[model samples]
Target: MIDKKQWQAEQAQFNDTSRYNDIMDKPRHVSHAHLPMTGRDRAGQFAPFAALTGYHELLNKIAQRYVNKKYPTGAEEQAIFDFFHQLPTGDAVRLELTYFNGESGYYEHYRGTLDHVNWAQQVAYFADGPQIPLRNIRVVNRKGNAHGQG
Candidate 1:
């Protein structure tokens, strides 16, 4: 603990504007003719530099979750193929589809009514709007029916 009078004296000295003004009023002597930098240019000098380019991107890629493409068994493949053939034409069929998302590089499951099935293109179009490739599909379930059923 400091004495109250001494503390007040110290505070008075620190708060003295004349002392601060005296230091700030001193002329700055520069050896060479150099133009003063703008605030933006001055900030650029202290801006953070990336030592290793793409390091953050590489780390983000490593941290991102990815689902490996699943290869169905012979029986499972046949079942999926059969379901595509049996689909009622022009009828909205509710389906649970698990397919690879190319953009995310991950497998995503979606439950929605299928708008169309393009046998030629081997893609299933969802009512909510998403065309999933049949080759990337891992699982399928018809609405009101159990898994593996059309």
Candidate 2:
């Protein structure tokens, strides 16, 4: 490698700007064929690109491996069935629900009014718009009552 003094002496010639005198004060060149992009548009050009598409969703599926779908025990299942049997059809009652989500292998909880049960379809409709299948339900209780009391 060249000594520091020698490198500095060699680079000193580039510090002289007398050769660029003709264009030193000229305005910057602008393209006529393309309009200037906005700051956001320019930034997006350098943004990280996902070469492996759907990698994030794959990672999410892998992360969900630790979450097992919760199933109701025989007693809990009986309690859920009893709750439905005791509540008169078409009579709305406030309830909290814990049910399995097979798609994500996790138990989801909801608190809403039990709109009615559709025995023919074996689905329990909630006032808030979820129609959960009876088999997937793990826990169901009247809102004010303690668990398994329903």
Q: Which stretches of candidate 1 lie over 4 Å from their true place?
A: 1-67, 147-150
Model 1, span 1-150: residue lDDT tens: 357999999999887787577679778876578877789988787666645667777766655534455567777777777877888888778888777786677788889888887889988888788999876677787765543422
Q: Report RMSD (Å) for each prediction in the order shown.
A: 15.6, 15.9
lDDT of 2 at 107: 76
**What would the TM-scores of all predictions be?**
0.49, 0.48
Counted clashes in each candidate structure: 0, 0
Error of 2 at 70 (Å): 3.1
lDDT of each: 0.75, 0.76
Identify the candidate with maximal TM-score: 1
* Colliding residue pairs in candidate 1: none
Model 2: per-residue lDDT, tens digit, 43-90?
788666645667777877776753685556788767777778888666
